[model samples]
Target: MKKNIPIFRTGDTIEVQVWVSEGSKRRIQLFEGIVISKRNRNFNFSFCVRKISNGDAIERVFHINSYNIGNVVIKKRGDVRKSKLYYLRNRIGKSAKIKELLTKK
Candidate 1:
């Protein structure tokens, strides 16, 4: 059975909880970042997330249908014009921030 993953798009700020295993022990790891890109290939669909930690940029690509993914929580919607936010890589500090898209809920 496929896990219920929320519908998300590039530029959205999201937190992904992943199941990590170390030998006989297992734990949930939280990865919070901005979605930079998405690849739609039917069952091979995947997405890339980027985040800054300790002054270094870290990016992780996760398969949407992977069982290791515990949950995906959308924090904020970004008002970006591009489908792939690759340009954000060159930015630093405040310049790298994406505008939040307001929605009537």
Candidate 2:
């Protein structure tokens, strides 16, 4: 049986809550980053996230239908030119940044 998974697209800023196991205890960790790339349109889909951590750029890929994921929250929508923001990897400081979409009041 195929389970219905939540739909997520590229160029979206998402907050992923993942379950982490430490020793005999388990906890949920929150990771807030921008979606740089997405692959596989089916249940075996996965997406990559990029975030600057401690003066270093860190990128992580998460499965869309993984049980370890607690929740996926969209923070802000962005306007991007390409499907993959791989160019951002070569940039730093202000050059590697993405503009936020402002809504009209």
Question: Pick by lDDT: which candidate is best?
Answer: 1
Residue-level error in angstroms, candidate 1, position 52: 0.6
- Candidate 1 displacement at residue 34 in angstroms: 0.1
What is the TM-score of each predicted model, taking all chains together? 0.94, 0.85
The weakest ten consecutive residues by lDDT in model 1 span 1-10
Q: What are the clash counts of all predictions, listed in order? A: 0, 0
Instruction: Compose the digit string of candidate 1's lDDT tens values, residues 1-105.
Output: 355788888999999999999999999999999999999987668999999999999999999778898889999999899999999999999999999999998
Candidate 1 residue-wise lDDT at 19: 97
* lDDT on C-alpha atoms for all candidate structures: 0.92, 0.82
